[model samples]
Target: MEPRPLSFYLLAAFFVLFVLFLYGPTLTIGILSFQGPEGGLTFPMRGVSLHWFRDLFQEQAVGDIWGAFRRSLVLGLMVMVTTVVVSVMAGLAFRKRFAGSAVLFYLAITSLVIPSILVSLGVGLIFDQLGLPVHWAGAGFGAQLTWTLPFGLLIMFAVFNRFDKSFEEAARDQGATAWQTIRHVVLPIIAPSLIGVALFGFTLSYDEFARTLLTSGSHNTLPLEIFGMTTNVTTPVIYALGTLTTLFSLLIIGVFLAGVAIMGRMRARAGSDAGKGV
Candidate 1:
C-alpha cells in the first residue's frame, strides 16, 4: 500500500466540504418542510407536523399541485424516450466522417450555449406569427427538447467515441441487418450510457423553467407552479413543495443509477462470453 500524500488528503477534504455545501441547504429545507401549520418559513419549528404534506393535496392549499406534477412527469417521460432514440441514431450517424458533420455538431453546441429564455421567447413569437396555440405538451415540449437534445447528443458522442467498431462488424458478418446490428449489438453495449442520457433528459425537462416559461402558456409544470407559489402564497407549504420535488428528482436518478449498476454487474458476470464477437 502507498503512503498517503498531503495533496490527497487536501483533495479528499475539499470533496467532503463540497458535498456538504451542495446539500446542506436542501437538507435544511426538507426538515423545515415538516414545520407545523402554525410555523413560518424560517427557523425554529413551531411544531413538527405533516400538516403541509396533507395540505399539499387540498385544492385550496396550492393551485393545481397534482395537475402540474402530472404534466411535468408526462413531459419528462416524453423527453426521455424521444431523446434516447434520437440521440442514439445521431450518435450512430456521427460515427462516420461525413460532409458538414462539423457544421451540425457546432449547431447543436450553439443551441446549448444560447440563453434558454431567448429560445422560449423566440418559440412563442413564432407560434404567434403562425397563429398556432402555445400548449405545454406542444411548444413547451419542443423548447425543452432544444435544451435536452444538445446534452443528449453530447453524451452520445462520448459514448460512441469509446465504443468499439468490431461489435457492429461482427454482427454484420453474422448476417445481421443494419437494424439488427444496432438493436442486438450496439444497443446492448451502449445501454448504460443511454440510461444516463435518459436521466439527464427527464431531469432537465422536469426542472426546466426558462424554456418552458412562455411556451407552457395556459398550463403550468411543477416548477412553474412553485414559482407562482413564491409570490402568491407564503407558508411552509413552499418548503414541502420543494422537498417533494427534490425527493422526486432523487428517486428518478437513483433508479437510473441502479439500472446502470445492475447492467454493469450482469456484463461482469457474463465475462469474456459477453464481450466475444458472435
Candidate 2:
C-alpha cells in the first residue's frame, strides 16, 4: 500500500490525544488503586499491593459511604422510573397537534440549555419560601428530578419520532382500544429505546454533583459523600472507590451490549427464515 498522506498522520495524532485527554485521569486512578496507603505518590512497582482495596472496606467512613451509595442508587432508580413514565406521556402528547404544544416544547428545551446551578438555586429558594416539607427541601433528590425530567422528555421525543405509527393502526384495526394498542404494540416496539433512556436518566442522576450540593441539604448522595472527603484529606481509598465505580460502569455497558447483540441476532435469524420461505 502507498504511504499515508500528512493529513492522515495529523488525524491519527489528534485521535490519540483526544483519547488520552478523556481517559488519562481514569487510568491514573485505576493504577493508583493498586498502591498501598504508605506508598504515597510514587509506586515501588514490586511493593504495590491490594491493601487499598481491602482498607477501603475498613475505612472509618465505610458505613457512611455505603449509606450514601444506597441512597444514590435508590435515587437513580426512582429518577429513571419517574422520567420514563413522564417522558412517555409528554412524548405522546407532543406527537399530536395541540394548543401551546410548541411553547411547552420550547420550555422543555430551555430547561436543558439552562445551567443546573441556577435551576437548583431557584428551586431551593422557592422551597424555602413555601416552607415545603423538610424531605423535599434543598439539595434533595426530589428537586433533582425536575432537571432529569426535562432531559428525559427530550430523549422520549427523539425515540417517539422514529416509531412507526403503522403498528398502532394495525392494532386498532383488530378492535383494540387506544390504551391496548399502546400497551401491546408501541411499548414492545420501543423497548430498547426505553431501556437506553432509563440508563441515561440513571447516569445523569447519579453523576449530578453541583445541583445535589445546592439542593441536598442534610442528605448525602455518593457524589456528595465522595466530594466531602476531599476537603479534609485525600487518600487512596478514593482511588479504590473510583476503580469500583469504573468496573460497575463497564458491567452496565457490557450488559447493554449483550442485549443489543442478542436482539440483532434474533432479527437476523428471522430475516433469514423469511428469505428461505420465499
Candidate 3:
C-alpha cells in the first residue's frame, strides 16, 4: 500500500479508545486485585501480593460470596438449557405456519420491550398472589427466561431462516421419520448456533442484576451479591472477586468457542470422508 488514508488512522484511533473505554475498568480492577495486604481500593500499588484474593477465601463481614456464586452458576446452567430447548422447538414450529402464529411469535418476544426491573417485580407479585414462595430457582429463573429466551428465539429464527430445507427433505427421502430427521439432520447442522444461544442464555442470566433483584428472594445471586458489596465492603477483596468472575466468564466463552471449533472440524472431516467414499 502506498499510503493509508487519514480516515483510516482516525478510525483506528477511535476503535482503540472504544476498547479502552470498554475494558479499562476491568483491567484496573484486575491490577488492584493483586494489591498487598496494606493496599486500598483506589490504586497506587502498595506492594504486589495475593492479599485480597486470600481475603476472599476467608471472608467475614461481606455477604455470602461463594454461595451467591454457586447460585449464579446453577441458575445460569438452568437458563442455558431451557433457552436452547425452547428456542430450537420454537424455531422448528415457526418453520410451518399455523393459525395465530404471528400473534404468538410477537407475544413470545413482548418481554423484550418491557423493563427488566418491572419484570422482576411482576414475577414476584405473581408468586405472592399465587401463594407460592418466591425463590431464586423459581421466580428468578422465570424472570431471567424472559430476558434470555427472546434473544435465543431471535438467534434460532435467523439460523433456521438461512437453513436449507433440502437437507431435511433428503433425510426424509432416505426413509427417516420426522423425529429422525430432526435428531440426525436438523440438530447436527444447527449445533453451532445452539452453542451460541447457550452462551447468550448463560452469560445473560449470570450477569443479570435488575431482573434478579426482586425475584431472587433471600438468596442473592453473584451479581446481586456484588452490588451489595459495593455499599459496605471497601476492600480490594471485591476487586479480587471481580477479577475471578471475569476470568470465569471468559473461560466459559472459550469453552463454547472451542466446542464450536471442534464441531466445525468434525463436520468438515465427515464431509471429506463422505466425498471420498462417493
Candidate 4:
C-alpha cells in the first residue's frame, strides 16, 4: 500500500482535537459527578462514590430541579409536534407559488437573525399588553417556536425540494385525493426526515436558555433551573445533575435515530415486497 500523505496525518490530528474540544468538558463533568462525598469540583479525585447522585434526589436548597425537568420534557414534546406539522405544511405551501410567497418565507425566517433574548422580551410584552399571562406553556412556547420553526421549515424545504414529483403523479394516476397523496405517499416517504425535524425541535427547546429566559414566567424550565442552580449551589451535585441531563439528551437522540432506522428498514422491506410482486 502507498504511504499516507503528511496532510492526512495533519487532518487526522485536527479531527481528534476537534472531538476532544467538543466532548472534553462533558467527559470531565461525568467523571467529576462520581466524586466521593468530600470531593471538590476540580481534578484530584478524593475517591469514587454515588454520593452526589444521591444528593440530587434529596431536598434541594435552591430551585426545583425535577419540576423543571418535567416542564422541559412536556414543552419539548409540544414544540416537536408543532414544528413537524407546521414545517410540513409550510413546505407544501411554498412548493406552489402564491402571492407574497417570497415575502412570507422571508418573514418566517427573519426570527433566525434576531437575538433570542429580544424575542423573549418581545413576547412577554405582547402577552402583557393583551391581558394574557406570560407563562412557559404560553409565551415561552410561542417564543421557542420562533427559534425551532425556522430550522424545521428549512429541513422540510430541503427534503421537499429534492422530493420526486413522480410519486405524487403516480398516486394521482391511481385516483388518490390531495390529502390522500400527502397522507399515504408524501408522509411515508418523508417520515424519516420528520423524525429528524422532531429531534431538532425537541433538543433545541430542551436546552434553550435565552429565548425562554423572560417568557417562561415564574416556573423555570430545566435550563433555567440549572442556570439558577449555578448561582447558588456549589457542590458535586451540580455535576451529577449535568451528567444525568447529558445522558437524558443522549437517550432522546438515540430514540429518534432508532426511529429513523426502523422506518428505513420498513420502507426497504416494503420496496422489496413490491419488487417481488412486480
Candidate 5:
C-alpha cells in the first residue's frame, strides 16, 4: 500500500493506545494465569501450565465463589427486567413534552455521571435507618436498582431518539389508541435497543462492586468475593478466574456488537426495500 497520510498515522496510533488502555490489564491477568506459584512476579516464560485452572476448580473457596456468581447472575437478571420495564414506561411517558419532563430526563442521566461510591454510602446509610431488607449478598440489589433504573432510562431514551415519529402519527391517524400505537409501531422498532439496554444493564450489574460492597448485607456477589480474595492468599487461581471473567466480558461485548451489526443489516435491508418500492 502507498504511504498513509499523517491523519491516518495519528488515527492508527490512537487506536492502538486505546486498545492497550482497554486490554492491558486483561492481558496481564491472562499471562499471570499461567505463572507457577514459585514464579510469582517473574516475567517472560515461567513455563505455561494449567495448574491454576485446576486449582481454581479445587479451591476451598470455589463453592462460596460460585454461590456469589449465582447470586450476581440472579441479581443481574432481575435488574435487567426491572430496568427494561421501568425504562420502557419512563421512555413512553417521556415521548411527549410535559412540565418537568426536561428536569426528569436530566436527573435520570445524572445518576450515571455521579460517582458510585458516594451513592453506595448514601444508600447504605438510608438502608441502615430504614431497616431495609438486606443480607451481604442480597442487600444491595434494591439499592442497585436505583442506579440501574436511571442507566436503563438513558439507554431507552437513546433508543427512542431515533424513532420515526410519523409511524406513531400514522397509527394515531388510523384511529389507533395511544397504547395501540406504542404496541404496533413504536415497540417493534425499538426492540433491538431494548435488547441492547438489557445487555448493557447486565454488564453494569455484573461489574458493580462499590455500591454492592456497601449495600450488600449477607450475600457476597462475585466481584465482592474477588475483592475478598485479594486480601488473603492471592493465588494463580485468582488469575484463572480473572481469565474466565475476561472471556465473559469479551463474550458480552461480542454479543452486543453482533446485535448492533444485525440491526444495521436489517436497517439496510429495509432501506433497500423502501428504495425498491419507491
Candidate 6:
C-alpha cells in the first residue's frame, strides 16, 4: 500500500476549510430563513418558524417572486439543453482540424475576456436595431450561451484529450456508421462530463445578472428579481428564497450524479457478466 505524502494531508485540510468558507454563509442563510416573521437579516434568531418560506408565496412589494422564479426555471432548462447540444457538437468538431478552427477557439476565448455588461448592451442594441423585442428566451439566452459555450468547450477539450480513438476505430471496423459510433460508444463514455457541462450552463444562466440585465427587457430572471427584492423588502423572505433555490440546484446535481453512478454500475455489471461467460 502507498502512503500519501504529508503535503497531501495539508492540501486535503486546506480544501476542507475552503469548502466550509464557501458554504458556511449559505448554511447560515438557510438556517436564518426559518427565523420568525419579525426577524432581521443576520444572527440571533428571533424565533424559528416557516414564516419566511410562507411569506415567499404571499403577495408583497418584491416584484412577483413566483413569476420570476418560473422564468428562471424555464430559462435555465432551455439553456441547459442548448448548451449540451451546442457544446457537444462544437467539442466533436474541434476534435478535427478545420479551416479557421483556431480563430473560432480564440473567438470563444474573447467572449470570456469581454465584460458581460458590454455583451448585454450590445445584444440589447442589436435586438433594438432589428426591431425585435428581447425576451428571456431570446437575446438573454444567446448572451448566456456566449458565456456557457466557452466553458463547455474548454471542459470538452479536456475530456477529449484523455479519450482513446481506438474505440471509434473498433466500432468502424464492425461496420458502424459515424453517427452510430458516436451515439453508441463515444457519447456513453463522455456522458458524465456532458452532464457537468449541462450543470454549468444551467447554473451560469440562472445566476447570470449582468448579461441578462439589458437583454431580458420585459421580465426579470431570479437574480434580477432578488436584486429587486433587496430594495423593496426588509424581510427574511429573501433568504428563504435563496435557500429554496440552493436546494433546487443541489437536487439537480444529485440527479446527474445518480445517473452517472447508475451508468457506471450497469457497465461494470455487463463487464463482469462477460468475464464470467468467458
For candidate 5, what is the total of clashing residue pairs?
8
Off by over 4 Å in 6: 1-16, 271-277
Alpha-carbon TM-score of each model against the true structure: 0.94, 0.86, 0.95, 0.96, 0.86, 0.91
**Clash list (residue pairs), candidate 3:** none
- All models, RMSD in angstroms: 2.2, 3.0, 1.7, 1.6, 2.9, 2.3
| Cα displacement (Å) at residue 58, model 5 | 2.2
Q: Please give the lDDT score at residue 127 for candidate 3.
A: 90
Predicted candidate 5 versus true structure: per-residue lDDT over 175-233, tens digit per residue:
99988988978877887788877886788888889878888777788898888888784
Model 3 C-alpha lDDT per residue in residues 1-278, reported as the tens digit of each score: 68999999999999999999999999999999999889899879999999888888875746689999999999999999999999999888899998888997887778887888899888888998999988999999999999999999899889998999999999999999999999999999999999999999999999999999999989999999999999888999899999999999999999999999999999888763555656
- lDDT (10s digit) by residue, model 1, range 127-246: 999999999999999999999999999999899879899879988999999999988888889888999999999999999999999999898998999999999888889899899999
Residue-wise C-alpha lDDT for candidate 4, range 43-160, written one tens digit per residue = 8899999998888887554458889999999999999999999999988998999999999789777988788889988888898899988899989999999999999999988998
Stretches of candidate 2 exceeding 4 Å from the true structure? 1-6, 41-46, 59-63, 136-139, 263-278
Give the higher-TM-score candidate: 3 or 4. Answer: 4
Runs off by more than 4 Å, candidate 5: 1-4, 59-63, 136-139, 260-278
Q: Candidate 2 on 168-187: residue-level lDDT in tens? A: 88899999999998898887
**What count of clashes does model 2 give?**
4
Global Cα lDDT for candidate 6:
0.90
The worst-scoring run of ten residues by lDDT in candidate 1 lies at 269-278
Please give the range of 10 consecutive residues that has the lowest summed lDDT in model 3.
Answer: 269-278
Candidate 3 vs candidate 6: which has greater TM-score? 3
In candidate 6, the residue pairs with backbone N, CA or C atoms under 3 Å apart (3 or more residues apart, or in different chains) clash, namely none
Pairs with steric clashes in candidate 5? 135-217, 135-218, 136-217, 136-218, 136-219, 137-218, 137-219, 137-220
Clashing pairs in 4: none
